[model samples]
Structures are given as structure tokens and as C-alpha cells.
Target: MEASTSERPAAAEGGVAPMVRFDRVTKRYGALTVLDDLQLDIAAGEKVAIIGPSGSGKTTVLRMLMTLERIDGGVIWVDGEPMTHMPGPGAAGSGSLVPASQRHLRQVRGKVGMVFQHFNLFPHMSALKNCMEAPVTVLGLSRKEARERGAELLSMVGLGDKLDHFPGQLSGGQQQRVAIARALAMRPKVMLFDEVTSALDPELVGEVLTVIRKLGAEHDLTMIMVTHQMGFAKEFADRVCFFYQGRIAETGAPAELFGNPENERTRQFLSAVLEAG
Candidate 1:
């Protein structure tokens, strides 16, 4: 079937087009469906947090956007352009949602950057080198320019003095900060954080969250975070989506959702989470 180009009206202030859209998107593994016809839209410069119980498929949303996992059905749009599929060779608006070619995927995927729960820094490379490698290699930036950018980002994450340190030498928070800098070096339009603070020690979580808060306050990037840090989500996100049974069961402004959730599932989930904390 030809992929539908229809999209929800721009929901941001001033009617700007959505930065990301998931239209009837589905993901399945064997007999289990991880994401079932999930539909979501994110406006440019918006901060969205995905939160739910363990099997609610919150992380899958970000993973699918990063192209780390393939969708079984439907389409995903980034910047109003087809992400999972490209326009076909012939007629206008005639393309289907076929498996995207590697070249096409690479071109579109560059618009996104993702930081994971575990610090995925190169253990052998110094923090500066780890931050510089991608910009120099994939982005084709000059070594000197990449280094400058890397140094600036590392410093922004409060790691200027640790530029020469390896991941092993740095604490969990510091290494995660380096990973954030590395992702930012690519200058992605959309940033995804998948449980970025999950692996950190209790005290260390604040440092990473502080950096993320600064980014949300200062930058115009569209940020999507999958996190269990309820307090951080309430404070940092403009909207919080509660996923249930592989679908977004409820979503609203942070205050509304956390303070007066409309969905029973959401209320129950929040109650349990709050009780656990």
C-alpha cells in the first residue's frame, strides 16, 4: 500500500509543522507486538517524556525513531519527510512504506541523535577523542574543527578538565556526560535519551539531569526522553506520555498528567511508581 502522507495539524504555537510523527506505526516480534499502531506527534523544540511500566514499550518508540528497530507496519515521518520509506521512482506521492535503503536511512537518520542508559563511550579513546570521532568520521568535519566543537561540548557538560581521561577513569556521571557531548557534536535536530540516568548512582543522576535541563532551557532541539525519573520528567518535560500495553494510554501537560491523570491506567501506574519511590 502507498504510505499515507496525511498528518495531524501542527500542534505547536504559531502552527509550525511537527518535527516528528508516528502514523499508525506498529512493531512486532514473533507473536508479541511491542508497538501497536502507535500514533504520536512532536512539535519542534518540544520536550516530551515517555513513562510507563516495564513492558509498556516506551523505549521502543525511541528505538524505532533511531532506526535501531524496524517497524512491522505504518510509517514514521521526520521533519515532514518520510523516514521509514522514501518517495518511489515514478509518480509524485506514490511511494510505499518499503524497507529504507541504507543510504537513505543514513541521510535521514543524521537528523537525530540518541544517548543510551549505559555510557557507550569508547573505553580506549580519551573523552575528547570519543566526542570527536563521529563528527570527524561520519560528518566529514576537519580534525581541527571537530576538536574545537568537541572541546566546547565537553566543557558545556562540565568535563573540560577531564578531556584526556578514558571512560574507565571517569565516574559514571562523567562518562555519560561525555556521551551526551558526543551526541551533541553531530548537531542533531532531535535528541533522544533512553533511560540515560538509569545506570547512574543515586547522587550521580542529578548531574546528568542538570545538563539535560540546561539543554532544554537553552536549545531549540526537539527532545524525547524515556526515563523512570518521575520528578525530572515532571520538571523538564512539556508533555508526558503514559504508555500502556504497547500504546500511549494517556498524554498531557506534565502538571495535568501527574497531578490529575485522566486515565485509570495512568493513575494506577503513577501511584505505584510514587509508592515505590
Candidate 2:
């Protein structure tokens, strides 16, 4: 499909704007394209789950939003501002998708945080220090204030006692929880979970999912999770998107998509996943 940029959708009847939008976005590695002219909009405070077989571009979607990967074409808008590009000088909303400057990117990225499958914690730092580092260094919080905030977040994820523990001393699940707390310390408006439990032992998966469930239920943050855990997705997500070969093949409420998938590919995929489980 050819890439095309388009205007943002009008606000909902309630006048609430969408928090994120992908307008005819595309990604490619040489001749092999991953995302093809995709379009998706996520409202503020919405919980969305992206699920599909490996290499279906589910993870790529999150990576793109976090600015880890650059788009080959089209634009991405965050909080109604261009993310993949900046407005031209004196053009005032009339510019093309030129590359965003580092300053612009950093400003836009402050509102987003991501948790990876592998616990990417610093081995040398204690849980408290790990959580406190970014907010102190990047967000400019004082050492005392960052420490207090980090302690509270660690406690929220059931790690109040593990504050002084190093990543080497913690189990995979505990380490992942620390990672989540670290992300939360940034006070991001949007959170991305990319197969967060995929690297954990089968028994430890539930612990991490439980914390995520709590976040979804209690916090007003917009969440987009790319997970293979269909049951959890159905339970926690307000909307579920199924991707196939980089395009959104099907999307709807969890109950409808998981219970009675309208697309044949979705049906086949669900059947395969269910049987594997």
C-alpha cells in the first residue's frame, strides 16, 4: 500500500482528543517492509493490547512510538504534535514529515516510558538507586525527592523491602517489577509493555502481570501492551488489535475479538494459541 499523510480525526463527541495517532506509517528494511501504510489512533487513558504471531510487527509498533526505530515513511503524532517530524519554520502546520531534531524528540519522548521483556536493570545499582537515577539525572528531581518517589513506586509494585537489593540478588520477576517501578518513576502519560513476561519462568509470569493489572485498574495512564498472553489481554485491555504482516488485520473490544473473531486469520490464530496453551 502507498503511504499517505492525513489530518487528525476530530475530537470525540465529548471533545476529548486522541493521545496517539499513526498516519499512513510505514517501516522497511531495504526491500522487506514491516509496517505498510498503517493507521491507528489511541485515546487518552485507553488500554490497548497488540497481539499476533512473532514477526507480525507487534513489537515494532511499540518501538516506533518510543522512538527506538525510525519510520521509512509517513508521520506519527503524539498528543496531537508531530513526532516523526517538526513543523517547518513559519509554516504553521503546513510542513512535511522532516526528521525531528534531538531537542524536539527529547521533549516528545518525556511523556512515554517502556518496559522490556528482558529486565534491563543496572547490575551495579540497587533497586532504589536504579529507580532513582533517571528522575534525578534527567527529570531534574533532587536526590531526596527522587529517592522518596522511587521508594513509593517500588512499594506500589510490592517491592518496598527490596529497595536496597541489587538486580543480581533479585529473581527475574522481582527484577522486572523494579523495571516497571523505574518506568513509573518517570510519571509518563503513556506506558508501553513489550512482551514483559516472555523471559520469565512460567511460574513468575503471574507476578509481573498482577502489577500491570493493578496499574491498568488504578492508574489513568494510557497503556499499550504487546503480549502473547491472550487471557490477560482479554481481561485487561479495553481494545485488542491483531496484526498480520505488519498491518492491523482485525481490531475490536476484547470480548468480541477473542470470543468471536470476525476475520478468518484471527480465528485461526486464536485457535492455534488456545491449543498451544
Candidate 3:
């Protein structure tokens, strides 16, 4: 079930370079350590799943990548650029915090887009408008161009007919799909899904998963997801990283990790989750 190189659309194609790299990155909240010296590398167009217990820091990785949370230590590189360092005014001779300018931050941040668990759609706007707003406001796309791209994305998510529908008028599954389309409008280099289906009803979970599966199968977007859906994770993820106590316990091909786990923590966690599944 791996997608072929030829299957990638022009928009999805990219060099086989490391899109993101986390080198011994650690995050802390006050005195509490959330991520303990985590090291990870995500290649272009690769789909990776992060699985762990409730407090295992799964969402922290996504938030850090989105730059929503600053790393307490270590560095993160995006598309071969140093995100933690920026140029500052040269102190009398030479010494500065390399003032991380907001302009530089915006440039790196623009390459990543995220879909949260809650459908963070603008409730006041129609589905089409929700998707169009960012492109027009941030990317400076013309109204006509943004509308066209929004329509295409809505069609891609099977919501072309619901373009005029507000978030309140849509079902949980439909709203999630719209949120995804909105993210795609940004044409990001990396996409993050943080327990996106966790908020949906049991029956609606499959619909959102179906959209994600299709994304993995057809699109070349580099995706990093933190999900509890073991079945989908097993079948969809090219690689899976199991975390334990804020650290990566094990990482490998999904078949090897899920079918023949190596780490004891992963084995125990997989057994518990799969049994409940």
C-alpha cells in the first residue's frame, strides 16, 4: 500500500530531502518536562504517526512544529533552515540573541499547516468563505483566485455542494473535512493532524479517516499525525513512532512495530489499545 513516486501530483512533489528535523529537542511547561530530548526526522512526503499514552507528549510535537510552543532546549530545522536562530543587530563588537524576527518566523511557519481536533472553522463564515479567508488575507490572493482555489479544495474534500453551509449547519465529519480543505488551501509543505477524529461520534470517525486515507494514498503531502486509531495507523502510516513518558519508545515500519513490536512499552501500549479496538 505504498504510493508510487509517479502518483504524486505536481503540487505534492518535492525533493527527497528532510523536510523537518528535531535534534534532541526538549519542551517544558514551568517545571514539568513535556518532551524529553526528542529526536526525529521527517522526510518529504512521508506519513508518520505518533502514538502514546495520554500524557506522552504526542501533541507537543505537532505544537512545536507549528511554532505554537517554543522549545526549552535543542533545535528544530525546517526545509534545511534553522528556525530557532535569526539575525539581530550586531552588538558594539559581536554578540546578540540573534533576534528571532517575526518576519523570519512567519516565513518558516508558513510552510506548515495544521488541522486541530476541534473543527476550528470560522462559525460565522460559509464553508467556502472559511477556506477563502486565509488565502485572501495572508497569502494576498485575489478574491476571484481564492474563490477558485477554495472551490477546488471543497470539491477535493467532497464538500463542493456544501460551500455555502456554515459550520453550525454541518455535521462533525463534514466540518472536519472543511477544516482540512482550509488547511490545504495554504499549500503547506507539511500538514499536522492532532487527534482530528477524537471529537467525532463513532459513526463519523470513519468519514474523517477516509479523507485522511485518501490524502495519504493520493497526495504527496508530508503528514505527521497523532491519532489513537490503531487500525488506520497500522494501514496508513509508512512509519510509526511509539512514545512512552515523553520520549520515543520505538519507531519503525508500521508492520514491524504493530505486528512485531520491539520495545516493552510499545508492546504493552499496543496490546492495550488493540484489545480495546
TM per candidate comes to 0.95, 0.96, 0.90
What's the count of clashing pairs in each model shown?
0, 0, 0
lDDT of 2 by residue, 1-277 (tens): 1233456556878788888888888999789899998899999999999999888888999999999998888888888787777765565655434578889999999889999999899999999999999999999999999999999999999999999999999999999999999999999999999999999999999999999999988999999999999999999999999999999999999999999999999999999999999
Model 1: which ten-residue window has the lowest total lDDT?
1-10
Which scores better on TM-score, 1 or 2? 2
Which residue pairs clash within candidate 2? none
**Candidate 3's residue-wise lDDT over 1-277, tens digit each?**
1111111111224545578888677888889899998888888888999999999999999999998888777667677665654434554223222424678889888899999999899999999999999999999999999999999999988998999999999999999999999999999989999999999999999888988888888889899999999988889999999988889999999999999999999999988987888
Give the Cα-based TM-score of candidate 1 against the true structure: 0.95
Whole-model alpha-carbon lDDT for candidate 2: 0.91
Segments in model 2 whose C-alpha atoms lie over 4 Å from true places: 1-9, 95-97
**Which residue pairs collide in model 3, if any?**
none
Selected candidate, larger lDDT, 2 vs 3:
2
Query: Each model's C-alpha lDDT?
Result: 0.91, 0.91, 0.86
Better of 1 and 3 by lDDT: 1
Residue 242 shift from truth in candidate 1, angstroms:
0.1
Count: clashes, candidate 3:
0
Off by over 4 Å in 3: 1-15, 87-99
